[model samples]
Target chain A: MGKLFAVVVTIITVVSTAIFIAHTWWLPPDISAHGHAIDRQLSETMISSGVLFVLSQLALALFAWRFGDREDGRRVKPFPGGATPMVVFAAVLVGAEILTLTLVGAKVWAGVFQTPPDPNSLQIDVQAEQFAFYFRYPGPDGRFGATHPELINEASENFFGLDPARDTSARDDIVVPTLTIPLNRPIALTLRAKDVNHAFYVPELRIQQDFVPGLTIPLHFTATQTGRYEIVCTQLCGLGHYNMRAYIEVLPQAQFDQWLKDKAAQQ
Target chain B: MRVRDLMLVGGVGLGGTAMMIGRAATPPGATISGKVTFTGTPPKMKPIDMAKEPFCARLHAAAPVLTENVTTGPGDALRWVLVYVSAGDQGSAPATETVRLDQKGCQYIPHVLVVQPNQPLDIYNDDSTSHNIHPLAKVNAEWNKSQPIGAPPIHAKWESPEFIPVKCNVHPWMHGWHLVLTTSHYAVTGEDGAFRLQGLPPGKYTITAWQEQFGTQSQDVTVTGSETKSVSFVFKATPY
Candidate 1:
């Protein structure tokens, strides 16, 4: 029975580890400029933790197999240095691993979040509602209009509650459901929530940010590739949260300019 | 045994004849027709923006769609108002036929739809983009479901009568109402702001008018014979 248990544990550990090693189910390819560092940090943590997991499981199995049953009725014996030393050593080793990973990961995290966005980066405003996301781009005026919550009326398509009638900047503001950005250019998004808490997650871009109702959060990223990716909401906001998603279109500089001009014309 | 069989057959025939006679004695019912109009200033309708939906944008490029919250017609006529027998109603029967709501051009075909309790409501998505239909129901169970392009129509029904505000989360401007009334006699005013409630028995009925923006108004109407009673409702509207 002990031998069977050891064998079962060994098989389970190997199979699970093999799945991760083979990358059968992994993240999508990174498409942002700062994504490589994040990927590296993630792999480092995964590899270190995986090795520890395998080693601990194997040691457990070995101990169980060797001391399965004392048919001779021998009393239990402590380790050479007592259990305290072993416990301390294991705790230190695990703690060191965690501390090292944190130290290394903090740099990457700071680069993406803590550091301010480039001054030349294109600024966009994002509003997250019950189950939809609306993106606003400052039009030719290059200024965002003030929003009035009282004037917000979804039926009239005044999503941001911009008083276009009075505010000239609001009149030129372009609001749409799709987020389009120029490739290889820094883009900063100020996220706000209309109702409850919501999250913006783009796996390819390696960017995830939360939107609080009373606060505006800023997220910055630069897409290295010119492709369309899905932006999904990770927060459990409401019943329609599962279907809350939008598209991010990264276009070339000239194409993006043309797209903006066309959008502005419609507005 | 033979005599008993003959009596059973005779009894069945007599019962059928009596049932037919009883049904024939009932009146053919009167109709309540009226026009819904507003007196004061109403809010101006704003054009909807469908640029996010390219298909809808191109569809309505020629004539843009307007908001339907307080849709007003010529001569202070109010459209999309639900008029029904609220009180003193004779009776209500279970709805058997299905009601359909369409999502086309990123807009609900009928701004307001009427359905009876337990009536099957079929919602169809005719647009290319997927739409999440969220019905905010207070009395009945609120549900949210998405219908992708080319997907099957969603078949749903409400257990209780409630005024549900239905909206498509994908398109913020897409708003509609689902009025689940217990009374069978109800009509939604058309573009001309005219409504006709037919097959109403001769009795005192409390007719109620419900608008999504404006609250509600009720009036007691009495029908004496099988005749058409002309009634009118004037709602005091505000710009705000």
Candidate 2:
């Protein structure tokens, strides 16, 4: 029985190690700035974690197998009151990993949220409700019009409660169901929630920011690749949570200009 | 090492401004569009409970039908079927173009809408009751917003690829979908399992169809600028 258990644990460890390596090795190379950072950090942490995990598990298994029925009755030895060095070593490993990651994470957060709005940046106003994200570009003036949530009426074609009659600023404002941006330029987004708290998250970009009601949260990032990436809400807001999706197109400069021209024509 | 080091490595690796080249850089792509319908018998339209959303329930009576009425003939077809174009040569950024999805009579209008990334979506709720738009997207931002009648509409955009489902919490059964694509070329098959898309620069294209209940169907076709090609796809019913 003891031998059987040992064999089983050995197989389990081997399989788990193979699985751990397979899962981590198969991911595509990191491309986004933040995504790459987190990916490398996570990969290193995982490699170390995986090694430690296997070592500890194997140690435990070996001890159990060898001692499972030693009916020889050996006296158990108690850990010395202080194994001070061992205790300190274990504590330092855990606390230090957390501290280091936190510090690195804080810096990444700052990069994502603190950089000043550069003139070369593209600006987008994002309004979140229930389960969807509404993005507004100041249109030609770049000055946002006042929007009253209280006045929204979808059937009457008064969505976003632009109050066009009352707020002339919104008259030229363009309403689009999708979002487009120029490639390579830093993009800043201001987020707001009309009713409840909602989170804006995009996995490929490795960014997730929340939309606070009555408060605007700014999130910024520069696209690294031309291909379209996916952005989804992390917070579970409502039933539509499953179907809430918007499109973000990163166009070349010239095409972007044409899009602006085309959109302006609508007004 | 440090975060800056990480970023330096990432920045160098992800350079080129990630700009969107024209559709020319993208291989040729075909469009697919079709209406979803039912044959033989149509299902009975039952009034769904909008108590949670009495405003919507009060204004609309039968559940909105995008799926063909399948009670009398064939089987339950086209009802809540998600049909979309799946494969195509990638396209440029999402146009400033916008699609409006209205919440009326406790249902989402334009039941099936296909959009590319970076485009805007206007969510409007007309009924006096409140309605929420939630998109369950893993690739794009996941958001939930509620609109009360007499309030402003909620506008949002997608920066990535995702298949979003819209629903009204007030009315549990009220459902709809917002399909976001990374590529600009795509189409949703209609009831007759037929789809059409025009405007091509002439090239080889891959067209795919999606059905919420029927899974996915795909095919490849070639089109020249002055040429129109015929494509057909069928999805046999299967229990998912």
The lDDT leader among the candidates is 1
Q: Report the lDDT of model 1 for residue B55.
A: 79
The reply for model 2, stretches above 4 Å from the true place, is A1-10, A24-33, A73-76, A82-93, A156-159, B1-240
Per-residue CA lDDT of candidate 1, range B76-149, in tens? 89988888899987785676766667787788766777777888878888788788888989989888888889
Write candidate 1's Cα lDDT for A69-174 as tens digits.
5578675687669989999987999899999989989987997789899999999999999778889999999999999988887875678988876788887898
Off by over 4 Å in 1: A64-70, A73-77, B1-107, B114-165, B168-171, B178-240
Docking quality level of the chain pair in candidate 1: acceptable
True contacts kept of each: 0.43, 0.02
What is candidate 2's lDDT per residue for B1-240, written digit by digit as tens? Answer: 111221222223223122122222223433334444443332233333333233544554364322221111233334334433355453545456555566766666545555667677777776666676666677777777768667787878888777776655444445667777766455443333334554455666666666543456566766665555666554444210
| Native-to-model Cα distance after best TM-score fit, residue A208 in candidate 1, in Å | 1.4
- Evaluated on CA atoms against the true complex, candidate 1 attains a DockQ of 0.24
Candidate 2 lDDT (Cα, 0 to 1): 0.59
How well does candidate 1 score on lDDT at residue B83? 87
Q: Which candidate achieves the best TM-score against the true structure? A: 1
- TM-score of chain A for the candidates in order shown: 0.94, 0.83
